[model samples]
Target: MSVLETFQLAIKNILSSKMRTFLTMLGIIIGVCAVIVIVGLGNGMQGYIEDSFADMGTDSLTVMIMGRGSSRSVSEEDMYELVEENSEYLKQISPTVTMMGSVKIGSDTLTATSITGISEDYFSMKGYEVVQGRGLQYMDMTDRKKVCVVGQYLNMAYFGGNAVGQTLKINGNTFTIVGVMAQEGSELEEGGTDDCVFVPYSTAARLSYTGTISSYAITVQNTDQISEAKAVVEQKLYQVFSDDDAYTVTSMAELVEEMNSMVNMIIYILAGIAAISLVVGGIGIMNIMLVSVTERTREIGIRKALGAKESAIMRQFVIEAATTSSLGGVLGILLGYGLSALATSVIANVMPDTPITVSPSLLAVVVAFGVSTGIGVVFGYLPAKKAANLNPIDALRYD
Candidate 1:
């Protein structure tokens, strides 16, 4: 028989037993869907992390000076000199000091707030906005004024309106609220602008009884010059700390690269796990094909007796198996993409800033479809060979 005739025969046979054909293809459907959904979620998470870093500004760098187990200790004065010397490379710099303390408003005491002491340039360097009142003035830091800026959460909780000019007690000391910050959602794992209470570095230094600041936020003149600026900052910091471990400087780009690598590793691992389903599906295909050959024994005998070559019998069965598996693969791809889109939409509602992206490349779909078809050829071969080699006389006499 011709190839077209064999294909028609295969289709007729499959259609004659619709329920059995569907059951045989079920495993392939599930396997393909599993792979697509797992890979899609991994890609979405990677995109969200990259976007978060981009919003924080790639031109910015953060510097931290260790206070213990170091050969040298960096002071606030060293940070000032570094900024002045590298004025061409540096745009804005601020030494930040932070500590946890209690805030008192009349009879209520909120003790879980983080108090951050910062210089006048801190707000601009960190991309913070003052929705009401104003940011810290130079005089506030220079004179160690007992004034502070409250976050949006505090303003909404205690004052219920503009918190500017309101008096609040901090760590039992009376301090006047000079500014109310705009709501900036959390970017890092620790906390964000919404959870902070800003004060002048001088007052923070006095309260903490230490001249050493926690960290510094520095912005570069241009993003392209980040490498040169980082080198200059590292040299300047080294002069004060002497040991490399005493201080650390990091840029947003480096952070993004590290996070991307970690996420990619996780993606491959999950993809490998999903691949196991494909193997299981292949095994299932082979078992069903074997059963199909036994059930169609009498048909095979009649075909062989009527001048049908063994090759024709084999081709008919192989084509049927491949067609069945391919159909399941196509359906799986459609269903997988639909589920991924639905999952992304639900995740968006829970976290507005996080974006879940599905990969637009059809590579995964094409590869999976090809694999499913290949699986059918390999697993269908034994059963097809058995049918082709059957003895027509014995097959006819048995039934």
Candidate 2:
């Protein structure tokens, strides 16, 4: 028979037993669906991680100095000089001093508000715009000014969005709010990114009673040269302390890459586990095809008695199995996409802050279909061969 005629006969046979055909395809359907969903979940998680790291700036590096047993201390001036010396690789540096205290705004004392002291250049580095009033100036850091910038959450919640020109006490020292940062997160919430305060690092140093600044945030001149800039900074700091343990330089890009690697490993492991179902499905297909061959023994005998070639008979069976498996795969992919969308919506509703969006890639869809169809071809071969090799004269005599 021609290929088309054989294919049509296979389809007719499958349709004649619809329930059995569907049952045969069940395993493949579930397997493909699971694989697609798992892969899509991984993709969503990866996207969320990248976005989180992007906000932190992959081009930035953070340095923490432990002062080398109190004998060797790297001063802020030393850090600035290092940046100035390597202007080609390094862009700008900001000294950071975290202040732990309650903010007393009028009669209310807000303890959940985070307070940090940074340079005037920090705002520009972080790309934070001052929506109200003005940001910290060069003089603020030089003269150790007590002025501060407040996040949108504190501004709107406490100051009713007119936080600028207001006064709030931190560490028992009153600070004038010179500016209000434009909202950081999508929406301002308590104890979120928008609930924070920033002051001059010089003032923070004195207020915290720390003689030496231990932490600095630096941005690289070019994003592509982050590793080179990090190397230079680490080398200089290593020279200053003469010990690796005394100072640590971390690149945000490197951290992001590491995080992505960890996430990918986890995804791959999960996907592998899910792929076990596909193997199970393939085995099930083989068993069903074997049964099909046994049930069609007389028909096989009649065909062999006629002008049908063994290869043609085998090819027909293989095509039937492949078509069945491919159909199952298409159904699974559709179901997977539906589930992915539902999962994303559920996550969004349940935990709105989470940035994950489950989306199955086209590559994943194509691969799932290919694997399913390939499984059909592999599993169908034995049954097809058995049917093709059946004795036509013995089949007629048995009846």
Candidate 3:
């Protein structure tokens, strides 16, 4: 018989035994569903992390002085000079000083709020928008103005979101709220940006009782120039701090790349774990195919006695096995997508802001289906060979 004829006969036989066919397909369906769910969740988590980092601004670098191995550390003036020298690479720079303080409005008090002391350039450098009033100016830092910028959360929680002109008591010192920042969500593990209170770095130094400000944030002219900017900044810091261990300079781009690599590694591991099911499914196909050959022994004897070649019998069985596996793969793909959607929906409810999305590639689906079919061919061979090698005279006489 021709190849098409053999496939048609295989299909007829498979359909004739519907229950057996369904049982054989069950393994592939489960295997494919597991793989899809795992991969889809991985992609979604990576995307959420990337988005959070993107919000922090990709063209920015953060410098922190550890002061572990050197007596002297990078100073605010040193940071300013570095920005001035690398004017072509850097767009803006901000010195950061931070402290924990209580913010109070009338009788209500919110404790342990982050009090960030930064330069006039901080808002722009950090990609924050001033939703109300005006941001701090150079004079604010130079004159040590007793003015502060409240975050959206603080403003809403204490001042009904209209604290732009209201006076807030920070650590028992009164300061005018000159600006209210736009609402910003949380950082990776740290608290939300909307909970912070901004002030001039000089004022923050007095509040925190520290003259030495060790952290600096700088915005590069372009993301492509982050490497050059980082090198220049590190060189400047090295000049100030003799020991390299005393200071560390990092870029958001570097953090993003590392995070993405980690996410990819996790996805690969999860996919590997899920692939175990496919192997099990292939073994199930082999077992069922073996049973099929035994049951059809009498039919095989008749065919051989009627002059059917061994190759024809083998091709028929192989086709039947491959068809079964491919059909299972197709059904698995559909079911996998459905399950992925449901999983994403549940994740979205838990974290509406960081919605989990299924972004499986076309190649992934194709590869999954192809692998299942290939498994069918590999496992089906032994059963097909047994059927082909049957003795016609003995098979016909069997009960």
Candidate 4:
């Protein structure tokens, strides 16, 4: 028979045993769908993290003093000397002193306030934009200004739209509000930016009574020179602090690379699990084809008696098995897309700031997964050949 005729016969046979065809294809459908959905979720998560990093500013680097052989604190003078010495690569450096304290204004008091001491560079590095008043300028740091910037939540809670020139007391010390930062989505992790408060580094140091800073946020002018800058900063810091292991430097690029590696590892693990399903589906196809061969034994003998070639009989059966798997694969693709969409919706609802993105590459992979299901015929071949080679005389004599 012609190839077209064989395909037609195969389709008719599958249609005749619709339930069996569907049952055989079920494994492939489920397997492909699972792979697509899981991989898509991993892709979405990676996109979300990248967005978060972008929102937090990409050119920023954070330097913290670890202990020298279990020491906890590093002196401010040491941090200053390091920055002053390597003033080429580093554009701006801010000494950070964090104190979780209550801020009171009139009768309203916000208790969950993160009070930080920072410099003018902090505004640009952290992607903060002033909505009202001005940011802490060069003059503010030089004069040890008591001016501060309040986050959106704090402004609404304490000042109630009257925050531009207001005075709020942090840990019993009063700081005049010079600026109110714009709402920064996920970047403002602890609620609105207005909820947190920023004071000059000098002012914060005096208020916290810790002459040493907790950490320094450093910004690099040339991102490509991050490695060299880090090396320079480390050497300078080691010289001034007298302890080579007193500080640690962390770059955003390194952090992003680590995150990507973790994401890739997870994707690989999930893909491995999904592969098991494909194997199970292939086995199901093999089993079903075996059963088909047994049932059609007499019919195959009659076809052989009619002078039908062994290759023709083999091709017909193999095509049928492949068709079954391909159908399953197509169904799986549809189901996978549905599953991905549902997951994206749930995640978006939960995290309005982080969006899930599904790329064309993911869709292409799903399509390739479906195409690979055609390998089911390879497993189904032995049974098909056994049927095709049956003896016509015996088949006719059998009841």
What is every candidate's alpha-carbon RMSD to the true fold?
Answer: 4.1, 1.3, 2.7, 3.4
What's the true lDDT of residue 199 in model 4?
A: 88
Q: Which runs of model 2 end up more than 4 angstroms from their true locations?
A: none
What is the TM-score of each predicted model, taking all chains together?
Answer: 0.81, 0.97, 0.92, 0.86
lDDT of candidate 4 over 1-399, digit per residue (tens): 998998898889889988988888888888887777777877777877877777665566788876554344556666666667777787777788787678887776767677888877788777679898989887887788889998877666566766988898887778899999887654544445446888888778877787567688887778788777888877766765677667788888678778988997998798678867777887888888888887877788788889988899999888888878888888888888887888878877997756886432456465546554555677668777777777888866655
For 220-269, candidate 1 gives per-residue lDDT tens digits of 89888888999998998777667788778999877887888998798778
Report the CA-based lDDT of candidate 3 relative to the real structure.
Answer: 0.84
lDDT of each: 0.81, 0.89, 0.84, 0.77
For 1-399, candidate 3 gives per-residue lDDT tens digits of: 999998899889889989988889888878777777777777787787788888888899998888754467666887788898889998889988877767777887867578889999888877789999999999999998989998888777777768888998888999999999887774321246677788999998988887588888899998998999999988877776667888888899989989889988988888888887788888888899899888888999999999999999999888888999888889888988998888888778987777769766566688889988998898889999999999999889866
Which candidate achieves the best lDDT against the true structure? 2
Candidate 2, 1-399: lDDT as tens digits: 898998898889889889988888888888889888888998899889888988887889999988667678888999999999999999999999998888888888888899999998999888889999999998999999999999999999988889888999997899999999999899888788999999999999999999989999999999999999999999998887888998889998898889888988987788778777777777877888888888888888888888788998899889888888888888889989999999999999998989689988888899999999999899889888887888888765644
Give lDDT: candidate 4, residue 165.
88
> Which candidate has the highest TM-score of all?
2
**Candidate 3 stretches greater than 4 Å from native:** 68-71, 186-192
Residue 23 error, candidate 1, Å: 2.1
Model 4 TM-score, all chains together: 0.86
TM-score of 1: 0.81
Ranking by TM-score: 2, 3, 4, 1
